[model samples]
Target chain A: MSAVATYVRLAWAWTRALAQYPASLAMLTAAQAVATVGELAALVFLFGHAGRLGGFGLHEALLVYGLAGLAFTLADLLMGSVERLGEHIRTGAFDVMLVRPVPALLQVAVEEFSPRRLGKVVPCAAALGWALAALPAEWTPLRAAAVPVLVASGTVICCSVWVIGACLQFVALDAREAANAVTYGGQAMAQYPLAVYGRDVARAATYVVPLAFVSWQPALYLLERPDPLGMPEWLRFAPPAVAALLALVAAAVWRAGLRRYRSTGS
Target chain B: MEAVIEAEGLGKDYTVAEGPLPRRRRRRVSAVRDVSFRVAPGEVVGYLGPNGAGKSTTLKMLIGILAPSAGRVRVAGLEPVRARTRLARRIGVVFGQRTTLWWDLPLRDSLALTRHLYRVPRADHARRLAELTEVLELGPFLATPVRQLSLGQRMRGDLAAALLHAPEVLVLDEPTIGLDVVSKTAIREFLLRLNAERGTTILLTTHDLGDVQRLCRRVMVIDGGRLAFDGGLAGLHAVAPSPRTLVVDLAAPAAPIAVAGARTVRVEGPRQWLELNGNPARVIAQVAADHEVADITLREPDIEEVVHRIYAGR
Candidate 1:
């Protein structure tokens, strides 16, 4: 079977299994939506006092926050289980995946698939739609096109970071926390204008992690704002390329980690 | 004969940490070293070793779960590590200590998932599932979640899941690790029938002697990261010191029983334990002619003893 088909089949099976417990699933999904809304509430309350964050008003800041939240949540929905590689490795479940006729990466990606994660999407989509309609920035065909491209490429970038972080489990075995620092922490860092964290942090997010491209650089173009770090204007269109390069790097790291894998004792 | 499973000097080296932090140094350790063996088609070979031996390492290399740090391995004419995904279609693996089935799903659902993962044809999957459910007796708990099933039931489910792909070769690790006699017997019988009917080549790594005695003709023993012995079960028996015993009950307490073919090793109140060197019947007859022999029971060497001898460098 093709890789996509196999992944869908595996994911679908898990989804069906999760559906068996309707009440618990509903409760968990409600909790997820409430959690996302709570985060947005904190952001909105901050805007109520400060009026502007890093020289961007409420809708402008919401645009960046929405794009980042949507991308991070999408990646989290798809590849969150990869973070549990350490647990699987310790328990030898990962070895079972290795012997299958499918790629281990694919197996790990779809593990514990739950539709409850879809709850996070609703608020982010609402915020992005509201911000897009309310923002005072001039809308152009090019800027409109950049929105989907930005979100898609950002999702890819976040997924790549997740895989790259998961590779640490093969060697360190307890690096999940360190990995979470990069992936979840990156999401937290991306939810505002990069300049809010100052110049050095902005440079690191831009060059080292490529997280700035997820929402910051592209949202700046949509907001018609100048680069806070004084970087080139063309960097707004750089997410897709950065995402592809990071994906290749992530794949290489994953292969190297798999090669270094020494399975648990029987 | 072309071997269905082949390994040439297959080895795995791990870098292990030693000592305390800051002063800790990494050391290169060989989990498996220079192990080579070939198994022909339709053969049930028992790969035996004590704990920490290289049995699992060898099996991992063969199944492509781990790449051998040195040497090579092939299963079903494909290099296991290089063509692991391709090779996986032709081999089924069961690690008795862990279940590959989804924990929260019912056994039937897990089996259905396996069918899709392996891409088994719908009709073939149905027929095979029916056969396995009947033979392994998985029907009663087919709808039970894997976590709720007993160990024996879970093992049967795991076996069904592994074989759902109709793999040409099956690799099982400790298939009967912890189970009651009845469950063990059921599994052994199922495996024997699988090999006989389908002619599936099996490389079983087990600490269970009964599993080996019942299902395998050829046995391989690995110790301290090397293949120590590999041959028939009878040959393994021969590697052990051949000291058969005859426990004979005498009518009265005696010093010892005098026999031509056996020597008295121990004496109780009314019984004598004689180590036989030749025909036990002749010894019993010789003792009966002179003394009142009440009863006699002969004991063969245990396979566990034979395996320990091999592991201890016999």
Candidate 2:
């Protein structure tokens, strides 16, 4: 069988095992969905009081928030096991991957498959749909088509950040906190309008972390808004290109980390 | 016979950071040094060592989990480091400290996953699973979750999981560490049968002397990151010669019995302890002929004593 097939089989088996505990799985999924709903409520109240923050109306801001949440949650569903790489390294459980014929990254990605994460997807997608229906912007055929592509590119960018965090676990096994700062922190910052942040924070999001490409830049294009920072208009279409570059860099870092790996003590 | 596994001066050094944060220093600790050995097809070799004696480190290198800091190793004619994925198809590894089977999944499911991972043919997988289930007595708990099984049952499950792919060489570290006598015997018997019937090459690191005595014809003893002895079990006695103790209860308390072939190490009111370097039978005969003996018992040296003697001699 091919590597992809094997990973799929492995993931399917885990899903079946998780299904054995239906009640707990349902509770976990509900908990995640409820938390996201609460966050959406907070956004609604904030927009209700202020009317417009950083020149983005309630529906436009909701679009950005919904897109950010969808991208991050999807990435988390696929690559969230990367967060446990530090624990695997510390406990020597990662050696199991080394002894297998399959790629270690694939094994790690499939090692922990959370069916509960499907819960967050429902709320985020609903919010995105509501925003798209209520927004006043012209829904041209090209613009309508760009939404899925942007969401996909955004997911790829978020997954790259997760892969990079997993790679860093090899060098610093206890750096989970630092890795979370980039992954979760990036997601938190990407949900807001880039114009709301200071110049330095916005620059870091664009240049240093590139999380702006995940939602903000694409939102600008889809919303037909101008760059508040006076940047080039072409930057709005850069998500796909930026995501590809980040994925390449993340793969290189992963390979370097594997080369330097030393299995934990027996 | 062709050699199935080979190592030439294989060693591993770990650089561990020491001291407090800002002033932390790196120190290199040699876990294994200049350890070289070979195992032929159909051979059962025992790897023996004390704690921190590098046995586990050497096994890790051979399995391709840990790359050696120096020298080289080859399993089934491939360098483990460069061809780890290829090598994995030809070898199976079991660490007694952990289970390779999924914790929440059933044993049968875990075995099925292994079959898929190795891409075993459907018919062959069925045959192998049946045979292993019978030999390892896995039928009783095949559907039970791994976490719910007993230690012995879990070990059996792990063994079956490892062999489902029919790996040419099986590398086991402490395969019988915590098993009860019944479980250990069952495992030992299964291993012996597997080697004899299938001609599988076996290399196991264990502290269990019973496992060594019953399964391995040849043994390798390592200490302080190096090979201390590599020969038959009898030859181990020569390297670390430990006296056999003979306890005799005399008719009455007498002067320290002057036996030529034995040394009187201790004396109680009506009992005497004699240490014999040569044949215990001859010493017993000599003592029996000279004095009236009530009861006698002999004690052979344990594995720990033999290992201790070897380390002390070094």
Candidate 3:
């Protein structure tokens, strides 16, 4: 079988096994959905008191939040198991992966197939739809076409960040917190307007980490809003390029890390 | 015969940091040093060592999991590290402490997934699965989750999983580590058949002397990151010459007995202990002729003593 088929089959097998415990799966999915809705509720309350925070109206903020949340959830569902690479390494389970004919990165990425993460996507997608309907911005053909591409780019960028964090396990061994900071923390930060953060923080998000390209900048383009930071206009079109570049660099780092891997003492 | 596995001066060094912060010093510890060996196709080689003897490290290198810090290794004519994926296709590995199968999934599901991962054809997979299920006796627990199976059952499952790909070489690290007598027998029989029938090149690192005695004709003893002895099992007695002990009971309290080929190491009351470097039967006859022998018992050296002597020589 091909690599893609193998991955899909493995993922399907995990999902089927998870489905065995219907109650726990349902409860976990519900908890994930409820937790994300609670975050959206906090945004609603903030918008109720203020017309707009950081020049983004309630609808525009929801657009960014929904897009970011969807991207993060999809990435986490697919690649969140990378966070456990350290544990696998320390426990010598990583040796099992190395002995397999498949690519280790692909194996690790699909190792933990959590179906509950899909629950978060439902709420995020609903919110994005609601925001799109409510926002008064012009719905041009080009802008309409860019929505799915932007979401895909965001997922790619988040997944790349996950890959990089997983690669760090070869060196750090205890990289959970660092990985969470880039993934979960980045997701939380990208939900709001980038303009609200300090100039240095904004630049870091734009250039260093590129979290802004995940949703904020893409949302600005989709919303047809002006760049509040007076940045380059091309920044709006940089998500796909940035995501591809990040993936390439992350893959290289992962390869280097694999080479440096001294398997745990059995 | 073509060498299925070859290593020349294979070694691994780990640089570990010591002490605190910026002033920490780096120390290089050699886990494996100047080790070299080759196994022809269908050869079952027993790699014997105590804990921390670098057996696992050498196996990891041969399986392409660890890159050697010095020298080189080739498995099936391919450099393990450079052609790891291709090498992986030709090799199957099992670590006794861990299972490659998914813990939560049933044995059948894990096997099915493995079939896809290795791209085993449907017909071949079905045939292989049936054969493994019957040979490993996985029928009862085929639907049972791996986590629920007993250690012995789980081990059988793992062994089957490792062989599902029909790998040319099967590298097992302590494959029979925590198994009962019955389980150990079952595994050994299966491995013997695997090697005999399939001509699989088997290199196993095991602490169980029974496993080595039953499965391997050629044994390699490693200690202190070096190969101490590598030869047939019978040659081990010569390398580590453990003296056999003879207890002879005389009718009365006897003076320290003297024998031509044996020495009396201890005497208590009417019994005397004689340590013999040569055959015990000849020495027993010599002692019987000299002294009034009421009873005589001879004890041969056990594997532990032989291994202990081997290590002690170092």
- Interface RMSD of every predicted model, in angstroms: 0.9, 1.1, 0.9
Docking class for candidate 1? medium
Chain B TM-score of model 3, please? Answer: 0.82
Stretches off by above 4 angstroms in model 2 are B242-304
lDDT, candidate 2, B211-296, per-residue tens: 98899999998888989899998888788887878999999999988888789999998899998876788889999999999999
Worst 10 residues of 2 chain A by lDDT: A257-266
- Residue-by-residue lDDT tens digits, candidate 1, A5-66: 98888888888888889999999999999999999998888988899878877888888889
Query: lDDT of each model, Cα atoms only?
Result: 0.89, 0.88, 0.89
Candidate 2 vs candidate 3: which has greater lDDT? 3
Q: Return the DockQ of model 3.
A: 0.69
| DockQ leader | 1
Tell me each candidate's RMSD, in Å, in order: 3.9, 3.6, 4.4
Error of 1 at A87 (Å): 0.4
Error of 1 at B45 (Å): 0.4
Per-model TM-score on C-alpha atoms: 0.91, 0.90, 0.90
Writing each residue's lDDT as its tens digit, candidate 3 over A1-266 gives 47788778878988888999999999999999999899999998898789798888899889998889889888988888888999889988788988888988888888878789888988999888998888687788887888899999999999999889878889989988887888888889998888878677778999989999988899888888788888888899999999999999998998899889998877
Model 3, range B156-202, lDDT digits (tens) per residue?
99999899989999999999988998999999999999999999989
Give the candidates in order of DockQ, highest first. Answer: 1, 3, 2
